[model samples]
Target: MKQLVRFFIIGMLVSGVLLYLISSLNQSQGYTGGNTLTIFNWGDYIDEELITQFEAETGIKIVYETFDSNEAMMTKIEQGGTSYDIAVPSEYMIDKMRQEDLLIPLDHDKLPNLKNIDERFLDLPFDPDNIYSVPYFWGTVGITYNAELLPDKTFTSWNDLWDPDLKNEIILIDGAREIIGMGLNSLGYSLNDTNKAHLQEAFDKLGTLTPNIKAIVGDENKLLMQNNEAAVAVLWSGDAADIMWENEAIDYVIPEEGSNLWFDNIVIPKTAKNIEAAHAFINFMLDAKVAAQNTEYVAYSTPNQAALQYMDPEMVADERFYPPPALTEKLEVYQNLGKRNLAYYNDLFLAFKMYGK
Candidate 1:
């Protein structure tokens, strides 16, 4: 009986050793059992497959969440119930977040792939030196029109949007800065003009466009344009590109008067619980091939210069989406106009919406 008991104990001891070795091996190969990174981003902004790839590669699970608007994202981060390790926000919002101390400075040493970004995108007015952010995607706000519907109309300027023939045939993106800026740009004033008189003039000008405005929408604008529901739309370049891809009849152009040149960048929120994993994700996204794949999926202009080689040559060559330096130089980036001025812009926009109603 004693000999049988000794054999039984030896067998149990060997099994325990084997289980410990297996666990250690799995961990070394990036099989982290509880590691996770939470991301707050714009809806439909990333390729879902990449999330799976990242998790498999690093064993760090992703808790992906999305917001439809920058304001909504900011509000949630400010509320502080959940700890988000990463968030994507536009340039102006990044400026606001930095001011509010809601972001943490990036450690460049961990983000070695940062060198892949184009020099033109870095050291910009917002987040100068990119202390708190890295360029994710960048594009302009402009007009997209259906060639089949407006065969005779070549929209080369913002003023063309006010054409009488276009009445009740135009869709506008639902954003105060974009719509108000369109009015401002039409008047040949700065999109960021903070003057009371200029703002009122812009407001009045938009009031005239009420007759032409078909509908104000968000993501649905793409579907409307694709289905030939609207003749023209004021859209972000990325959204325009997606629409054009679906409907060959669709064409996009930046008006001669210039418009908002915006940048959406990756940032680390102050409430990050997995700082290391956050850095890992940033570096993973910055990889040239990964960046190319993402831009291809999202239909956004990438700031990853090295990634261009991996992108479709014809798509990259399209000047409407990739404007020349001369044109880009003329474009304007939105600035944080402070809370009161921003509210004023929103109020004016709301009043304009009501005017249309």
Candidate 2:
């Protein structure tokens, strides 16, 4: 009887310890069961140190999560089970979300630091009135190639992705919008091609390159290129910047054929329960020093003009951040594709992924 009571007491003690640990973790995450600000961001997009700093400074607990793509982030919110105070989405998505009324018009009066943003990134077509978003990171989609792996291969355009010699030596992005968009741009068409026939052309064009592509990958392009797993890869400038810093043997290019110029912005969601905290976090990020720290950490271009002063001059001079005027003049920004064409693109994307190989 005594042994049974002792065993019960031990079990109770263990349960108590576990409950305490869980509570402590929640507290550390700022879930204090109150005043928590939830942020859904891109994977590894922020300087984590800044998150800690913000938490310490404001005493508002941060509940953080990450989404790999804008579509995935949209689905989560639209499904209505999860709630986040802030989300980072690219240009096209800002338009899509605003159209769907998933975002709240930001109270700029609460965001004085918005002034620090570069004028060039402001008043853009996607969110022209600056009613709903603030530019965070902006970059271009381009190619990264291995010098030794491609020996003597000239890569001045997206046409190179279809070159016969690159068979099984190339990697393409898995995202439907990016892959098809590149195909469209390669043909001198808009990356946001919405016409049914034009999108079909993009699908057919991309299909031709599938036989030569080693794989259609997303974030995996980082390790794939770093290890020289492929001779060339369709990659974003932000990632290209960091990877080149790690491997000098690789180089990036803004294909003369042009590519997508994108901006990922910060916005409060309609479901944001803590508006004050969300605005505070956005304002904190707009601080020049903080913006530079994030850009330096993530290797993405910042829309914060003042942050340039703190950036490495060499990095600033590098074409990855500041491409030649010849290419920049032609870079195209994607617009939201309405339902009909979005489905057309998605259908072709599905068909490509399932049977192209």
**Candidate 2 residue-wise lDDT at 282:** 97
Error of 1 at 262 (Å): 1.3
- Candidate 2 residues lying further than 4 Å off, grouped into runs, are 1-35, 79-83, 200-204, 350-357
lDDT of each: 0.92, 0.87
Against the hidden reference, what TM-scores do the models get? 0.85, 0.85
lDDT of 1 by residue, 15-131 (tens): 999999988986776545349788999998999999999998997888889998899999999889878999999998898898889999999999999999999989998988989
lDDT of 2 at 227: 89
lDDT of 2 by residue, 175-252 (tens): 778888897998889887787788778878888888788988878899989988888989888888878988899998
Lowest-lDDT window of 10 residues in candidate 2?
26-35
